[model samples]
Target: MKIINVHSASLPALLLPLIFSPALFAADEQTIIVTAAPQTLSELDTPAAVSVVDGEEMRHAAPRVNLSESLGAVPGLQVQNRQNYAQDLQLSIRGFGARSTFGVRGLRLYVDGIPATMPDGQGQTSNIDINSVESIDVLRGPFSALYGNSSGGVINVNTQTGQQPGTIEASSYYGSFGSWRYGLKASGAVGDGTQAGDVDYTVSTSRFSTHGYRDRSGAQKNLANAKLGVRIDDASKLTLLFNSVDIKADDAGGLTESEWRDNPQQSPRAEQYHTRKTIKQTQAGLRYDRQLTENDDLSMMLYAGERETTQYQSIPRAPQLNPTHAGGVIELTRHYQGIDTRWTHRGELLVPVTFTTGLDYENMSEQRKGYENFVMNGSTPEYGQKGDLRRNERNLMWNLDPYLQTQWQLTDKLSLDAGVRYSSVWFDSNDRYITPENGNDSGDANYHKWLPAGSLKYAITDAWNVYLSAGRGFETPTINELSYRSDGKSGLNFDLKPSTNDTVEIGSKTRIGNGLLSVALFQTNTDNEIVTDASSGGRTSYKNAGKTRRQGAELSLDQRFAENWRAKAAWTYLDATYRTNVCDDSNCNGNRMPGIARNMGFASLGYEPESGWYAGGDIRYLSDIMANDENTAKAPSWTVVGLNTGYKFNISKVNIDVFGRVDNLFDREYVGSVIVNESNGRYYEPAPGRNYGVGLNVGWTFE
Candidate 1:
């Protein structure tokens, strides 16, 4: 294992050019308002490190199927597609969620002011509707703590609102590996918004199917979303939101190093066990806003959702002999709901100020069951069929948080933003499938934390600003992590403790040549960092390590240089390592953290105009990444290139768009993601080779 010092002599060389270059400075760019900050502030004026991506730009010449397509240029964020839709994407921020084997953790996710993350700190991006998105706000560094638990970072997605002119559109796309997507959208306003009987609505639906790159890896998804706003009176308005998604995917499982070297597309055990997963989810929300007085207002939001999931793993029949072993088939039905009420006052005491306070409450209940994934067929074992029940349990989780935030303008050039949140979470479980061999296994646990964050900003000029921010945050173990004991027991691990950390960051935002440039340096120190203990037979256990440290620097540039030409680039350098000699099986004192890269970069150049032909190309690079805590193996460094070309035109009162794209232009073979600490050494997930796609969209507006 090797270590890279972030403060070496190379630091000055990178920081000097981006700060002192006179040619880079220019007139102010277009202002972008963001809600990720404590108060609604422009991206340039916000005290924290924040970036915004326009939805129209993201879907211009792309598939618009996954976030990995457009989020590669955001500094301090990493999104990886595993080519297997059953497991979802791998997402992390500044090494915060790198340890996760599946799904997203250590970050907060929001869709149109509704919380997409559960109370247990586990989240999934499968429900996001990219085609209807208006903009995405990514907030990083210390100020993220204002969102409460698991706030390593924050991602907020807002969908487009209806306009005065009504429009209907249809779109379709076809790609490699027998992939297809079809979508329809409609948006319009019935009358003027100021009137009592006015209404606005936006609705979208899409279906996607793919024959995946790996063997036996196939998936199909159906999704729908709708938003409607109604004017109730002169002082108040109401908005309704609805979303649903259904998915069925076959799991190919991970491949060992030797297996990947032989055939990257083969699944060794998936054929024998028929591994697969199915999911169905539906959710709705309501939001209301009212004006009470000249300087005060109120806003309230209520949301509820339900989800059901079933999965079959490749666990062998030998494990079923153990009376205490949970079976290979898992079923879960979960119901969740939440509410948020907030009040804002824009009065001044010492200076111009904006004060806001809110209370959030959430609850979830689930029924979990396990069954043997095989049955007897004339004395012979048959796989992929439910045989007998092995485990049954009911679990419940809830959280309550109260928060306060304020922004003050102390002077003309300096401002301050500060906030605090008190969070309390409770967990309870009851086991109902206990037999003589597997005695009663039930438990309860609770956790509490107080998070505080603050930031100060100073403007050097109208186009340049510098800021400093710091905060405290914490993360509690999810229900899945507490399911099995490290010692191969049959009860929840109540001894596991929550991890806590403190982060500090210094950053600068500059307007350069009709574009925006951002640079940031950050560090975080964590106590009781969670880690994998042992994993086998499709089950994983967890334990806490003593201490860890993460430090990094990020630089991003988005410039429109010449007419009809655009350029964008982002670079990240990170040093993450264990600080203590707490041993699981070996001394991992100074080892580099698993599933993290030391360096990552992205750059793209494009020639685009308001109409007619457009073209672009991009390159992405990643350094070697460790696969486990022991640092015995790693994924080699690799780079890939991509190209896209498109055309747009109008004819006979109709709009049309056609586009084509090619990925992995150089046909590079690399590992896309890693399953950390796999007991069977099946850690590598291979990336696809060169692939091609084409899309078409047609729309018409009614007058």
Candidate 2:
């Protein structure tokens, strides 16, 4: 194993001053309680890296449309809007999920304690209703491995709970490119809960539409979320959750270098194939919590969901002539469910310790079908119409995991946190459409692993602490990654293997004056790293690279200097590369991983009071990014600035807020994201130029 020297970078010149400056010291700020760790502890005491984004701050002076708008301040995390809704947001944490073409992979996601990621490690953020969110917690570094498979990072979203005073809110926003959003939310509490029958509830619904920044790229979405909690007794409680989302979007397809340079807004083949996607999903979950004894507690969660998707691709009719082709129109219907039960005990073991044990089980079954996208019209062929069935299959995946975690206070200023989980995953595929030219593709694969993690922390003083952590994690190929074979054969890629990684990290946290500052340095070594082998006409194949390494450093500071002024900054430097020669046509032994930036930075300043008026400005920076593993093409570095201003006032019992914002102030044209290893060399997805938006929110509280 080789270790990269993070101190060799120039970032220390900018970070060292903030760490040792005595002039910056002042009074301490309020303590922030976080639950990202198994034991509820203050952020300053947790031995891991965690950040919280307040829901109110995320919505303030923003369109509240996508997570990309508010999550840029988080270090070691990248969120990009492709400007194409057909493909969801591009999210990668510490270079973990950078290879994903569609949807999120290599990370765990949760909403209200229910799993948003499936048993197969595939997840989507479309169903998250930001209008009702109370806060979002992001956990990074080695500690993330405790969450089970694909635990490169963990994100949990908690929604608002009803309070005593019932309130109703209505909001609307309009932006450039004919984009608009409208939302409604309501929350309240019914009765006092010394006994049963006391209930609290919150519900939110929203609709969004966009004409898009590119030709033939338009989308519409509708989302609804509701949460209800009931107190059974002083020691038990039950909560119910429901979420639904519907989306319809047109796929503009990516552009080659020449096409992007000539006209970034043009969709070359979209008109001929009429590419598009439609999705509908609904999910419900129930959670129960009980206090069994004075020192023991139990919690259980059960959830079920159904999702249906239909997509039309741009593959030409010539490809459909092949007997083994799976056609250009794809359809999928999936049913999934999961359960998690855990017990926690707090007592004195050699020292004060909190121990938790849990079991998790999840299952998913999908019905997949494909059809030709063209039909014969006399002598000519009509495109974009379903022709004939060409492929059909049923895919099932399941996972069972048992885990244990313990936090021990070894001394007054020292602590230890450790955990272990044994994960088992199974996948099976059954072919339903069999022909003389196509053979049966029935296949199954199973994988198992034991993940372990430990952290040690020591407090140097009342206002500062340092910690070191290490862990092991693994990622299983999602059903989508296993759908196609690189050889163009008509069978599942049963030969694919799961990728495993070992990570080590050290970090420091300090309370300086009226602010908090954090620094972290980390490295990860991976075996059997997944890479894109071929991607064209919306079909992609995957292969495993021999080995890879990721080393990086992150720094973040949130400070409030004056009574009404605040400042924030975050920066990350990553050096990710292939360690072995993985030849697909060219050797890429030392090439930097594709779709990841070497350096990224963000800074913001804001001023506000209790009411009256408010204003803020922010700037974002990204270094050049590689487009593919061969290192043949790249996207240049770019920076953009934005400004927003808003006002808040009250009329009797009604409160109102209005704001406006402008992005890409200088209109610097840049690629928002890339399609790694695209077989057709159509890799660039251009971002929008200058854009403007205005929003209004009104609320009424009943006394």
Candidate 3:
């Protein structure tokens, strides 16, 4: 007798029987299906790197549980927690968005077509709840032209819409670092299968707490989300959404090189600062489809949404004082509103020639304030320099884009796809301050630009495809990056030329039995890109790298085989280098771009028993990457492993799942981010050493 074991390249073949088995064809059951996705896994067919996160995988990677940790394995992506509430969460892809010390930039975030990124370039993606997601689409590089303002690719999160039958889920988690979390979800329809149309709704709520791995870094968070669906007919529907999140936490300030080694958790912020922030968002949308004379149909959409956030931040700075890192303050008040409308006609114009044309519009504005030596115990200390006039202002940006796309079947074995978009953006901003560049400009300025982008994809065979596409991408500086000027006036006051890039990609996609393999190679060149010039007078100033290029390859595979086994593996290599120097005399030219690893990948193998038990282990690897323009600061490549497991009930609406993960499983000490640091000595904060955690969940469904 022989026992068999199947993994990465063989699991898909093994899973075929169970997935398509006759046992799943119960006559009384209703089947749920996801949206149709793009074909081809190769780089050539996509002209971009796109990765998917399945809904089932979310259970092991809960929002308040393994949220940031599980995401570590995503290719070309980085996730970091600053331990400071004021500093926004760190998430960057391909070195596109590391400058954000307080908020997100250089990336576009979308959830079912509603923009999660603010118009002024600020974005919030931490709210994405894995439990509510149906699938997550990660589009890397400048390959996504259908979506505008995308400097990097797009992260499209599709949630589980209203369901036909009622379902309920509850989860609880506990782990080291004094962590605990609880979540609940319930969803279903109304009127016991109404006659007019089916209406469905979903609600999700969660709470979490953690004792700091470092002093005063602990945090508590509460969140909730609700969704409603109205069905107009079999071909049309509408959705309404609302979400809220609140957080209270202590701060983890930066540690000195020596202090970090003595105790990585030691920081003035740990004892002197506390922060509280809350965010609320709401959106409504209409989706419709009508068959126009059989082969031609009309599809339209209208969406409107808004989000508001408020935070009070205070920290003691070692500025002009001998001791007592005891007091300083920063307060942020932001509110945003926007809407999008699109209408398209889908049909064959001349037999085998199909196309879609649509228009898009977005607008937004925000209010903010900052101060120095702002004492929380009394009136804000008026300790300041000269010529500081106003403390309040409005910053806004808007864009209008129209596009056309067509797909043609050239022959029996060949087809073609093409699309183009024209976009115009407007900026209306105001700032009051005495600076070196503006001479205390008080009012406002308006700027506008036109951007055009396009792409092409072709199918070479039934099981394989190839694509080649080149598209233009542009990014405007953030509000703070533009209007901010402190003390001696050394901030950006120029019209701030837009950052732009163009890319070309080619690769092959193939599926053999239980194996799905995709590979792509591409090159991206940019001009007027934002980079830090450290040699500036006394501070790091944002300057154009002049020109640069980032080229790379991506390969990923997922397979399920053997009676109870599965595996997933992915690998990526990126090379980003500057093409020109600053001032024409510096050796910065040809320097490697920071935060882009030359080699990175992930591998995981899982197993299940004939009974109700399952477990899996995953490993991640990253190569050394430059952390500064001069290549003086570098973060050595590091690897970490993760482990998780749980179980499910075969019958009944009730099911239980338990899982745990250990970060930096091998205790590899390394700095994850170096935004404001450039020193070579002293390994920055040791990446969490061997973190362990576990979760438990139960779900129910009622008819």
Query: Per-model C-alpha lDDT, please?
Result: 0.81, 0.83, 0.56
> Mind sharing the TM-score for model 3?
0.83
Q: Compose the digit string of candidate 1's lDDT tens values, residues 526-601.
A: 9988877666545678888789999999999999978899999999998999998655679999999888898999
Q: What is the lDDT of residue 289 in candidate 3?
A: 38
Give TM-scores for every candidate, taking all chains together and pairing residue i with residue i. Answer: 0.94, 0.94, 0.83
**Residue 223 lDDT in model 3?**
70
A best-first ranking of the candidates according to their lDDT comes to: 2, 1, 3
How well does model 3 score by local distance difference test?
0.56
| Cα-lDDT of candidate 1 | 0.81
* Clashes, model 2: 1
On lDDT, who's better, 1 or 3?
1
Which rank order by TM-score, best down to worst?
A: 2, 1, 3
Candidate 3, residues 1-703, lDDT tens digits: the string is 1111111111111111111111211232201011111111222233345666765665653435433555544566666655544345666676677655445677777665556776545687655665676666666654453455534555666766666678898988887788888899988887542334778787888888888677766777777777676666654555666666666655454454566657776654335434444455555555443434343445444556555554433333334132211113333455554544333333455546544455556777665444444332353333311111224446666766655555455665454545555545555555544334334333333333333333344456656665555556666666555653322242234544557777677766666567667777778788878754431111233555679888888778877788678788888788888898743345878888775678888898889664477888888887886656667766677877777766655466676666666666777665555553332232243345677777877878786
Highest-scoring model, lDDT: 2
